[model samples]
Target: MTALPQERRVVTAIPGPKSQELQARRTAAVASGVGSVLPVFTTRAGGGIIEDVDGNRLIDFGSGIAVTSVGSSAEAVVRRASAQLQDFTHTCFMVTPYEGYVEVCELLAELTPGDHAKKSALFNSGAEAVENAVKIARAYTKRQAVVVFDHGYHGRTNLTMGMTAKNMPYKNGFGPFAPEIYRVPVAYGYRWPTGPDNAGAEASAQAIDMINKQVGAENVAAIIIEPVLGEGGFIEPAKGFLPAIAQFAKDNGIVFVADEIQSGFCRTGQWFASEDEGIVPDLITTAKGIAGGLPLAAVTGRAEIMDAPHSGGLGGTYGGNPVACAAALGAIETMKELDLNAKAKRIEEVMKARLSSMQEKFDIIGDIRGRGAMIAIELVQSGTKDPNPAATAALAKACHAEGVLVLTCGTYGNVLRFLPPLVIGEDLLTEGLDILEQAFAGV
Candidate 1:
């Protein structure tokens, strides 16, 4: 087997000559509304190193926001996808079905958390998957109200915008959001109203009580949540939170939807984050790393619930494009063949050790949390848990200047999440952590 790249070899300052030229071109050609990190333009990426247009090599830690878990250009993914492209690209599964699409659905039904004879529908983005999941739930339960948690991020679509909690980029100026979308407190341990110990289950129960009293469980269609909150900070719900909510949904006849878009495909040390809690959701939305960087998303749920929407209810023109299906199959194969779940666990072990050490040394690191490779360090003011967004931003910039790409997320933008590809090597991983430590020290 070919080994992954190691070490950061900075040939020129980041955004080197070629990158500078490309950046100028990008400014003119691309939309200013789009945002990017690490101005360096990538020419090639394999395993952990992203070779930029200037031929400068940098260690990757973001994994394209956890979308390339098997690596940016895994041999398996490339080979399979290329062959499929040669054959054909799109023949929308809705208009003209294809075997590849059915194969992907079969794989999803078998691998998704539940084993209740599930069915699946595909979409092009996470937001679409979430929207369709909600539609399916409402159709199945015959209810209008859908509940979402604070600090949860669903997507950028109209309905998902209301489901999403963040306001700045995702929801700002994009109102009036869809109605019947309710927001409740999440089981955020660090900023919990109650302490972290038993607060998770308590918060969940309390939220359910509010829904019952306010929205009325009978009128609620689904409770959509990220098993591990993604853009709202990589906050993993308290131990009992997911199970408690799922049980409440089951008892109240409300659908339970797990949004695993950012935490699926072995990113959280499991095939799906919901698997960690051992709770089976009625519907699950997935994207991000599902197709190894291809734009593919899916909603998998109990057969009856998925079939609730009338014959022509759930579909899109580009939904389940053959090329994306092929890529997804390849991505799944790569994950299984390389044992990426175990690789994620291994990355977690390294992260816990390094971040724990950093925590002892740097008061700025308020909390370190996440499962497997989906880890994060929340920055805070010295001697207090107050979010320190400025410090986080400075640290990220410092890392980027040093040819180590990192990403910042959290409601306050005070959290640095490390979502390196599972295939990253120990040497590069340690080097990236070293740069982070230096950045913290410099700050």
Candidate 2:
């Protein structure tokens, strides 16, 4: 295996000749719907660096949107997946189940935040896992209505589209979406109508009231939420909000599903972000970092609730492909051996400290929120909470030009999110932040 130099190096233009040609080819061959944050094309990536075809080694602050928390090509992940590939590729778990799939399920049951008898069903993406969680909840509760939050992002599937709050890119023209999905206000502290202090109590109370009066708690099958909301900005619900919602769901017999796809797998210092609030969800959807970049997702929850569906109800052919399972096992091993949870906490400390300092200098940085390595800076008009999407776009472009891979998100399209690999060196991280400060100044 070739070890890529972790240091960032820009030998040519950001999208040099080689990447430019590839981008042209991609435009012709690939669909326009598949959006990319950066125009440069990577030939190799490892240890916090994405080596593009132009020989530009860019610092990876994105980590493929938190899919490669152990770095793009971790040793254990590569070794196990390679061994599994040589042994066998696909033997659909349904037709001929394998030990790797079962092992992953066992790990999920053990690692996810729960002390109950847990069970898991694998899938190929976060969206699919979420879809299946809804199925399980509906089957178990015998209800049709599902409650979601205002700024929560579930997935891109038909059902998830209906659950998602944003309409521009995710839901627009993709409708009409699946019925029986309801969206309610989230305890978004920064823009909370009353104030951050009251956000938790007021928002959760209002959300519960909506579920009771409008959807009717008895009619609700599930109340799914990202413990820390992704896509709709990395908005962590106000403190006390999660417990309140979880309690409300429990009081009403509604299956509480924690969509921890992005915030799970040590990205947020804990095994799952739900643990932060000591909230034990009835069902948790996981993906992204689960397989160290391989496409794998799962719905892990109470065994009784999970078994609600029939034998033939919840699985896909590629749900637990043996190779992907091997990768997952390796990824989990890496997380344990390296103590990535602690590393994630260290990252939170370092990043939040640096970003908090930056917020002092840049008024556009309206809010610096998020936990652990999964952090974000909400950009806004100077001295006001008004979103500054134009400034966000320009700043991202600036970072791109300087060979730093940063990403942007938010309902108003004005958040710069950071999800660097947990294994990244402090040197690279500090350098990336330096570039960020420079980019902000230029903006």
lDDT for every model? 0.91, 0.94
Per-residue CA lDDT of model 2 for 1-443, tens digit only, reads 12998899999998899999999999999999999988898889988899999899999999999999999999999999999999999989999999999999999999998799999999999999999999999999999999999988999999998999999899888789899998888999999999999999999999988888898899999999999999999999999999999999998899999999999999999999999989999999999999999999999999999999988998898998899999999999999999999999999999999998999998899999998899999999997989999999999999999999999989999999999999999999999999999999999
What are the candidates' C-alpha RMSDs? 1.3, 0.9
Work out the TM-score per prediction: 0.98, 0.99
TM-score of candidate 1 to 2 decimals: 0.98
For model 1 the local lDDT of residue 51 reads 85
Backbone collisions counted per model: 0, 0
lDDT of 2 at 125: 98
- Maximum-TM-score candidate: 2
Best by the lDDT measure = 2
- Model 1, 328-424: lDDT tens digits are 9999999999999999999999989999999999988899999989999999999988999999999999998898989999999999999999989
What lDDT does model 2 reach? 0.94
